[model samples]
Target: MVEVTPPEGSQVVIEMWSDLGCPWCYVAKHRLRAAIAQRPDADRFKIVIRSFQLDPRAPRKPEKNEQAFIRAHGGTAAQVFQAERQMQAIAREEGLEFSLDRLHANTFDLHRVVRYANDDGRGFEFFSNVQDGFFAGALNPYVPDALEGVAEAVGLSGHRVREILASNEYADRVRADRAEGLELGATGVPFVVFDRRVAAPGAQKVPGYGRLLEHVAGPVPSERVS
Candidate 1:
């Protein structure tokens, strides 16, 4: 079990820049969660998700599998397949499932849902559910009804989701998040920034995050501090 509180001056805040269609980002999310859970003072830490779009050129519908989109965007299918296998192995270790057959759709609206979730104070849970919907079940986020279903499942109103999809609600927030990531020197997704003190870029391991957290929150002596 983890404590909701930690020693004074020991709180850590992490900002993760990620995209829904990015395989490594999904793995990174799981690793962060697992690492936090391992700490006795998990609740003292907060993980804020910052949006990034790996495939902004991706269509708004499911035209093909992710590989096809990547191929159309210039990468070879074999390359995508090889990367998928490696990522799937890592995801499995983190108790996450990946559906490589899923379509690669534009993530703009999906990110809007994330902002709304943040407004509702359920951003983290909504982000987790979106990851599961995309990687575990291949749900297409650009599909309005499908996205609404996901929002409803996470306790968000389907009507509100539909409204968001219908308009440009929270669109600026998504763009602002990406801008912040870029300003932080991120040229890619899965960039983890810890309290403006440390920045790690990639699908880092659980222990890697643990080390970062420890460094940020100070040493945990005898697990009592945590």
Candidate 2:
């Protein structure tokens, strides 16, 4: 269990730059939640996950397995295998079931769909799906049908998702998000900016987050100081 205190006059806003297909980002989200749970005034903080595509040029449909995808994306065969083991370990620790076999290497279409979801008052829907679909379900997020399925799973309109896929609206927003992500110094997925001051590059432990949040709120004052 953790202890919490009332929020100070200052509020904490977290700008999270992440890629939907990044396993590390999902783990980071879980760690962030743990930190929030420790704070009594968690409501004083607003967290938003922005988009940052790791593979901006990825095709709409990738033709590779998880191992090949990782290798093509800069990691070697051994490295990819090690990463898979690490991902499995982390998923287990987080109490999440991971389906790595079902994952596809592409994320462009998935990202485009998410942009449309934002406009339909379900901005969080696609984001939530990516978190689960990529990190847990290990589904090919770039496929149109897969993305549509994700939308349906999240209670969003499947028809709308299909419509977005057919149009250019969603793709434009994906471009915008990528631009903003770069401007915000998020060159990689799962980059986090906390309290507009502290920044973390990837998935960190709960204690690190706790310390950061505490700094944002400052120290609790004694009654005599008041």
Candidate 3:
């Protein structure tokens, strides 16, 4: 088991567990960002992005569009289409566009990049670019150019990002994040922890999140760890 020390008595920590491929995770992230932006005590709010795998057994390479993937997983056309509509509607609400029919790649490499960004203080910007590239720009996360573009956008070396993806750096960090998600009883992506006192399992409403932030902002959980 991994050991973590929760914040000292009055610190508010937010840990977000998400998959780069999950549309709702993207939406949930924005809602959380909004929640933080509206916080009365923004200085005390800490945000940490954790990792989760929607398909733990996903292939290393992306083979085709998401449509074929759905079928391969035994999803019916009607159901898949409906899900696409739902995703698009929500994306629109969140000021994003969705082309769920486009190619979907394994996010293992991209997530590693984000982990690096976190260490370098560019996590949020890098994470935003990854989602924007995939869900909005229809870019394949596995492609070197797409991944590098995000890196460059966030003031990191694209070449370095490519190097990290080519190697096994940060792989353990990704695994640890996933393990923590399971420990938190997260059955899906977009799992959120507020000061470690409250756990939100999915994409929640914005207004409710704003209120939750205010409530959670008051007291930190006792001896909880990220």
Give Cα-based local distance difference scores for all models. Answer: 0.79, 0.69, 0.76
lDDT head-to-head 1 vs 3, winner: 1
- Model 3, range 103-221, lDDT digits (tens) per residue? 66567777788899888877767887778777775677778888788788889888889899789999999988899888878888888877777788889988767766766664323
Per-residue lDDT of model 1, residues 1-226, tens digit only: 1334345656677889988878788888888888888876788788888899877777776655645557566687787788778878878877888776777667888899889987886777788777887888666665778777877788888899888888999988999999989988889989998877778998888899889888777654455554
Return the top candidate by lDDT.
1
- Predicted structure 3, TM vs. truth: 0.84
Measured with C-alpha atoms, the lDDT of residue 139 in candidate 2 is 64
For model 2, the stretches where C-alpha displacement exceeds 4 angstroms are 1-11, 67-78, 119-122, 138-140, 152-155, 218-226
Look at candidate 3 and tell me the lDDT of residue 121.
Answer: 74
The 10 consecutive residues of candidate 1 with the worst lDDT sum are 1-10
- After superposition, candidate 1 runs with Cα above 4 Å error: 1-11, 66-73, 221-226
Query: Is candidate 2 or 3 superior in lDDT?
Result: 3
Worst 10 residues of 3 by lDDT: 1-10
* Displacement of the residue 180 alpha carbon in candidate 3, Å: 0.8
Q: Candidate 3 — what's its lDDT? A: 0.76
Tens-place lDDT digits, model 2, residues 1-226: 1234335655667767777667788778878877877776776776766667786665555544454466457767677767778888887888876665654455666667766666665655468666776665566566568777878877788888888778765676678877876776766878887766767777889898788777767643344543
